[model samples]
Target: MTVQPTEPTTPRLEWFKSSYSTGNGGECVEVAAAPTHVHIRDSKWPSGPMLTLGPGAWASFVGLIAD
Candidate 1:
């Protein structure tokens, strides 16, 4: 089963890109943190689909990647 990304409606999301992102248009991602979930999308495609993860799942993913 494919889990489609949820798109936000109404209020605009405040996305923040990594400080490591260079001005040369390199690969980058942006994230918006909500109360229950975190939204992730490509920095170059602000209007594109976003991957939403619950707080627990997002924290676990971050922990793994930080290792």
Candidate 2:
């Protein structure tokens, strides 16, 4: 699987937070989408480590969480 690299050499993305996110900032994540991959990072640390997933994997993850 290929991932959209967002290293220091790559441009940053406009990430969207989940609707479930609250001002309490307890546990929240942000996501950004590209043509072939989806990028996910911690909302509390936008510049921190990230997890990249392929389109199909992303779909399955979302489906599992939605169930």
Candidate 3:
């Protein structure tokens, strides 16, 4: 039997783009907040793929990058 993945039942996410985004055309990153996870996407393609990571994982990623 073919298995179909269940869709996200979570409510709509509130996406926010970085303030550093250039007013002109350029690449940027967008992020969204979920109850237990964070969603990341490319600002260049709002409808593009998203990378979802746990809150802890996101925090660690940020800490590492900030170091």
Candidate 4:
């Protein structure tokens, strides 16, 4: 996976951690659902950089993982 630059100047966003995430915070990823795109970030660092993906791409990725 490629790491992108963190846009620290962006506005605040409400992040939702996956149900699969552990309370101890191991390999946790949070997703912020938006109208146009999906914003993903590490639950351990809410202020960190986010990877934005298109809705269709995100749905396909999730479907593959679900299977």
Candidate 5:
């Protein structure tokens, strides 16, 4: 996984929060994905730095963390 900075020319991505997230403010993250990359950011900051990963990396991460 890599940290990616949002560029001025970066296209708008469809970001979604975790289903486990309640409506109330809490520690959470949002994700957006493209065919080649996955993006993750703090739910509280849309314009903040993002963690970008290749599809394989994302899958590996999910596998490691998922129950």
Candidate 6:
């Protein structure tokens, strides 16, 4: 038996910073959405590493954080 690992291709994403973010120096994040995943990165570091989550997982995470 042979095993192969499948890697997801990087998609061109249009990222936007959180609306709550102000120009002042503060911790903020940016988000981009693809058909099957959501990407998150630090607002201050646009070219930094990103965190990816599936649609369902993203929804669940948002639900947990919503007020």
Q: For this target, which candidate reaches the highest lDDT against the unseen true structure?
A: 5
Lowest lDDT sum, 10 consecutive residues, model 2, at 5-14
Clash count list over all predictions: 0, 0, 0, 0, 0, 0
After superposition, candidate 2 runs with Cα above 4 Å error:
1-11
Tens digits of per-residue lDDT for model 2, 1-67: 9988665965558899988887786757899998778999999898799999999999999999999
Against the hidden reference, what TM-scores do the models get?
0.78, 0.78, 0.75, 0.75, 0.78, 0.77
Task: List pairs with backbone clashes in candidate 4.
Answer: none
What is residue 5's positional error in candidate 5, in angstroms? 24
lDDT of 6 by residue, 1-67 (tens): 9989977687678988888888797757899999889999998988789999999999999999895
Report the C-alpha lDDT of model 3 over 1-62, residue by residue, as the tens digit. Answer: 99999978868888888777875877478899888899999988888899999999999998
Candidate 5 regions exceeding 4 Å error are 1-10
Q: Given candidate 3, what's the lDDT at residue 17?
A: 80
Clash list (residue pairs), candidate 2 = none
- Tell me the spans in candidate 6 whose CA falls farther than 4 Å from its real position: 1-11
Give the CA lDDT, 0 to 100, for residue 49 in model 2.
Answer: 98
Relative to the true structure, candidate 5 reaches a TM of: 0.78
- Give the alpha-carbon lDDT of every model: 0.88, 0.88, 0.88, 0.86, 0.90, 0.89
Comparing 1 with 4 on TM-score, the higher-scoring candidate is 1
How large is the C-alpha RMSD of every model relative to the true structure?
8.9, 8.4, 5.5, 9.4, 9.0, 6.8
Q: How accurate is candidate 6 locally (lDDT)?
A: 0.89
State how far residue 15 of model 3 sits from its true place (Å). Answer: 0.7
